[model samples]
Structure formats: structure tokens, C-alpha cells
Target: MLFPASGHTKAHVLHYYAQIAPVMLPHVAGRPASFVRAPEGPEGESWIAKNPPPGVPDWVPLVPVEHRDGVTEQVVVDSTAALAAMVNLGAYEVHVPQWTAAGGRDAHDRLVLDLDPGPGADLVVCCRVAERLRQLLDEDGLMACPVVSGSKGLHLYAPVEAVSGRGASAYAKGLAERMTVEHPRLVVASMAKLERRGRVLIDWSQNASAKTTAAPYTVRLREGSPGVAAPVTWDEVAACRAPSDLAFTPEAVVERAAERGDLLAGLLGEGVRGRVP
Candidate 1:
């Protein structure tokens, strides 16, 4: 078993990926993916690998991503088999860019704002911050989708016409700065630990071309319960009053997807079109 806490075997993880692939692949396909591997199980050490390891199957898709060092082949999970294979390889989480690999590094179709709560704050605090962020986006005539980070906070994503990653990052940073200024009690744009005492950190820097976020439905291997980066409805967000309400397991996430379909499917299609003012 790869996850000792959950007692989930490698086959279980593989099945989870295979079952969720139909709804999850669109978010992963054609994107440069960085995986978190726990070869010795969740109780042991884990490492993040950006480059595709050797001996990957020929059918598995890979894209040559230029890093500061050089071009390295990055694995792109586009098929159910590829997804399952990655799970079998001890990858506990899938992280990807906001744009397709074909779009290059700078071209991003989405802007992400990470609502990270301080040590004193919690998920419910993040939920409130996310709703406020959503309201602001709506005021700007943009639509925002919220996803439980499966860790400590929430991630708000807005789809826009293809924009440069630098441009998107700048826009998000400006929005976060404005929010911090307007709502000092609840939002903090600065990364300084002391500044985050009672505020949620609106991490706009995630829009950078080199940055990545957890793919929706990807399972996370933490110390305690395994968490799934699951999509949630606005209603769910409104109802969330505790962190446990947002946390989901592999089986639970699969079941939720089966019953609710992909709540994040709209992001792949035409979404709200607007630029940050």
C-alpha cells in the first residue's frame, strides 16, 4: 500500500485514477505535470519530480519543457493508462500549469488566486475569503470557481481569454493588493508570516509561468488522512464551516464525481471573458 494512513494499496490508487480519468484528464492533458512521489509509502519520505523518469512507457505522452538548466521531458498524463501508470509509479499528487503545454510557458488561459490561511486562521476562514474573492470577480464581470486545496486552504480560478502568464500574474497580484488594502482584517497579500497573523494570504504569485497547482481530483498524501483536491459547488463552499467538510478521500472523491459530474468542466469550455482592471 502506498498510503499507510488510509491503508490504500497501489492498485487502489491506480483504480482511482482510472475511474476519475474521464473527468480529470481534460485538466491534466497537454499540461506539463509535476508529480509528488512517495515510493516508500505515505509514512516514508516523498519527493517532487519535475522531469519524467527513465523507462516510462512509449505510449505515455511527454513534452520537452525548457527549464533554467535545460530542456527536460516532462510527463503529460493524457490517457487513463498513463494516469494509472503514474499512480503505480508512486505519484500521490498531480500538479499542472494553467495552460496547455502547446501554449508554451507564457500563454495562460486561466488566472489562479490561492487563498492560504495563516496558522491562526483555518479553512472556514479561507472559505469566507474565497466567497469575498468570488464576489469581487463577479463585480468585475468575471466568473470564479473555488476548489478545496486538499491541504490547508482554497484555490480560486478564473478563466479568461489567453493571456501572458506574466500579465496574469501581475493582474492577480494587483487584485490581491487591492483586496488586502480594502479588507485588511481578512486579506493579506504579503507573504510575511507576521503579516498573516489573522488574515488569509491571497497568493496571486501562483500565476507565474513556472508555477503549478494541484490538479482537480488529485489525491494528496499527507501525514494524517489522504486528501483529494476535489471540486466543490458554490453551495458547498457556502455550507462549509470547517476544514473537515472540504477534505475528501480517494473513494469519496470518485463517488462525488460520479454523482455530481465534473463541477469544473465549465473551465474547459468558454468561461467569463474579462481582464483585471
Candidate 2:
């Protein structure tokens, strides 16, 4: 079992990824991936793997990524088989940078802001913050999509013209800082935990070139229940009254995909893309 508390087995994880591959692959396909693996399950020892794990087949695609220390060839989940291979290796979560390998390491085409609720705050609070953020992005001529993170938070994604990773990071950081100034009681941009109490943290740092956010449609290994980081609509975001309202299971996400199709499909099209300024 990959999650002893939730009674989820490795087969369950593989099935979810395979089923979500069609919509999920477009967001992650050309991006270098990092995996959070728990061979002993969620409660057991888990590690992040940037490079391909031992025993991965030769057919899996590997792309070289250069870090400050050195270069490592990271796995790219470009196909269903490639994704399943990662799951079979005990990966419960897949993370990828905002930039893609095909666009080069510095070329960032997406902007992501992770809305994290601190002490005394919850998903309800996050929903309020997300609405304000949507307005801010709208003023900036960018349209943002909300995704329930499946682990006590929400993520906002927007498609922008290809810019340097540093450029994207700067824009996001500025927006986050502005939110804190305009709405002190509702938002906090600082990373310090103490300052986060009673407010939501606008985590703009995820846009950094080296950082990764949980890919959309990936399962989270939260205790008691496993949650899928599922895409949501603006109407649903406004309708979230409790944490459970936004929390989605893997099975539920698969059903949603079949019924509503990809809610964030606009991010993939060229016509909807915008610039940071």
C-alpha cells in the first residue's frame, strides 16, 4: 500500500495518472519533473528524486538540467507509459518547474501563485484571497485559473508570453507584495510563519526558475484521505463554503475530467496568452 492510513495501494496511484494523462500531459510533458516518492507509503520515509530513479527503463525520456552545483538528467513525463513508470517507482506526487525544456531553462511561459492559509485560516479564507487575486490579475490584463491544491491551499495559474524566469518571478513577487499592502488583514506576503497567522500567504516564490509546484491532476499524500490537485472554475471557487467543498478525490477528478473536460484549457491556447505588465 502506498498510503497505509488511507488504504491506497500503488495500483490506485497508477490508475489515476493513466486516466488523467491526456489532460495532465499538456501541462507537464516538456517540463523536467521531480518526484516525491514513498516506497513504504505516505507515512514512511519519502524523498524527492530530480534524476531518474534506479531501474527506470531506457525508453523513458531524460532531459539534462543544470543546477548551481552541476547538471542532472531529469525525467520528462511526455506520455502515458512514462507517467506510469514514475508511479510504479512509488512517486505519489509529481512536480515540475513553470518553464519547459523545449522553451529552454530561462524561458518561462506560465505564472503560478500558491495561496497558502496559515494558522486561524482555512480554505474559506483562501477562497476570498483567490477572488481578490483574480481581480488583480484582470487589471494587469492576465486571466488566472484557480486549482484546489488538495493539501490545505489553492494555486493560481496564468499563461504569459515567454519571459525569463527571473522576470516572471519579479512580476509575481510584486503582485504578492501589493496584495499584502492593500489588504493587510487578509493577506501576508512574508514567508515567516509567525506573520502568517490569521491571513493567507501569497506564495509568489514558486515562480522561481528552480522551484516546482505540484502538477495539476496529481494526487497528494495527505493523511486520512488522499486529495487530487484538481482544476476548478471561477463559479466553483466562489461557491466553496468549507474545505470539503473544494477537496476532490482521485476518482472524483477522473469523473470531472470526463464530464467537464479540462477546465484550464484556456492556458494551453495561444490566443489567451498575456504579458506580465
Candidate 3:
């Protein structure tokens, strides 16, 4: 079983990934990806893998990512078979950077802001913060889309005219700082735990070249029910009265994708590209 407590097995994980692959692959395909592996299930030890582990099939592509120390070969899940291989390795959670391997390493095609709720705060507060962020992004000529992170909080993504990773980070950080100053009670830009109490943190650091966020449609390795980082509509975000409203299961996500298609597909288009300024 991959999720022992929840009674979900490795087969379940593979099936979910297979069903979601078509819509999911485009978003993650050229990105340097990382995986959170729970070999003995969620209750057992789990680790993050940036480099491919041994025994990976030859068909899977390993993209090289350069760090200050050296270059690490990161796995890129470009096809359904590759995604299945990741699942077989006990990875339920996939994390990827804003920039893709196909695009220049330093060039970011999107800007992401992770809305993290601190103690005394919950998804309801996160929804409020997201709405405000959507407004801010809209004013900046960027169209923002919301994805319920499944673990906690939400993530906001906007398509941008290829900007440098540093530039994306600076733009996101500036927005967060501005929001914190304007809405001190509701938002906290600082990463400090004490300051974030009862507030939602606009985590802008994920835009850094090396940082990663849970890819949309990734299944989070959490307790209780399986939660998929499902993309959501603005209407759904506004209507999120309870956390359960946004919390989606793997089965639910497959069905939702069938009906709504990829809610974030607009981010892939060249049209409506927003400037970092």
C-alpha cells in the first residue's frame, strides 16, 4: 500500500497518474522535477528525490539541472510511461520549478505565489488572500488561476512573457510586500512563524530558480483522505466556505478534469502574456 492509513495502494496511485497524465503532463513536461517518495506508504519514511534513483527505465528522460555545487540530473515526466515509472518508485508528490528544462534554465514563463495559512488560519482565510491576489495580478495585466494545494493553503499562477527567474522572484516578492503593508491583518509576507499567526503568507520565494512548488494535479502525501492539488475556477474559489469545498480526492479530480478540462490551460498560451513590471 502506498497510503496505508487511507487504504490506497500503489495500483491506485498509478491509476490516478495514468488518468491524469494527459492534462497533467503539459504543465510538468520540460520541468526539472522532484519527487516525494514514501516507499512504505505515508506512515513510513519518505524522502525527496531530485536525481533519478537507480533502475529507472531507459525510456525516461533525465534532465540536468545546475546548482552552485554541481549539476544534478533531474527527472522529467514528459510521458505517461515516465509518470508511471515515478509512481513505481513510490512517489506520490511531484514538485517542479517555474522554469522548464526546454526553456532556458533562468527563464521563467510563469509566476507562482504560494498562499500558506499559518496557525489559527485555514483555507477560508486562504481564499480571501487568493481573491486579493487575483485582483493584484489582474491589475498587473496577468490572469491568475487558483489551485487548492491539497496539503494546506492554495497556489496562484500567472503566465508571463519569459522573464528571468530573478525578475520573477523580485516581482512576486514586491507584490507580497505590498499586500502585507496594505493588508497587515490579513496577509503576512514574512516567512517567520510568529508573524504568520492567524494570517496567510504570500510565499514568493517559490519563484526562485531552484525552488519548486507542488505541480497542479499532484497527489499530496498526507494523512486521512488522499488530496490532489487540483486546479480550481474563480467561482469555486469565491464559494469556498469550508476547507472541504476545495479539498479534492484523486477520483474527484479525474472526474472534474473530464468535465472542466484543464482549468489552468490558459497559462500555456502565448496570448495574454503579462509583463513582470
Give the clash count for each candidate.
0, 0, 0
**Per-residue accuracy of model 3 over 54-118 as CA lDDT, tens digit each:** 78888899888899989889899999999999889787799999998978667899999999999
lDDT of 2 by residue, 167-194 (tens): 9989999999999999999899999999
Which stretches of model 3 miss by more than 4 angstroms? none
Score residue 141 of candidate 3 by CA lDDT.
96
> Would you list the C-alpha lDDT of every candidate in the order shown?
0.85, 0.90, 0.90
Write candidate 1's Cα lDDT for 141-229 as tens digits.
Answer: 67898888888889898877778888888888888998888889888999999999888999998898889999888987777667788
Residue 145 error, candidate 3, Å: 0.8
Global fold similarity of model 3 (TM-score):
0.98
**Candidate 3 clashing pairs?**
none
Q: Model 3 lDDT vs. the true structure? A: 0.90
Error of 3 at 216 (Å): 0.7
- Give candidate 3's error at residue 158 in angstroms: 0.3
TM-score of candidate 2 relative to the true fold: 0.98
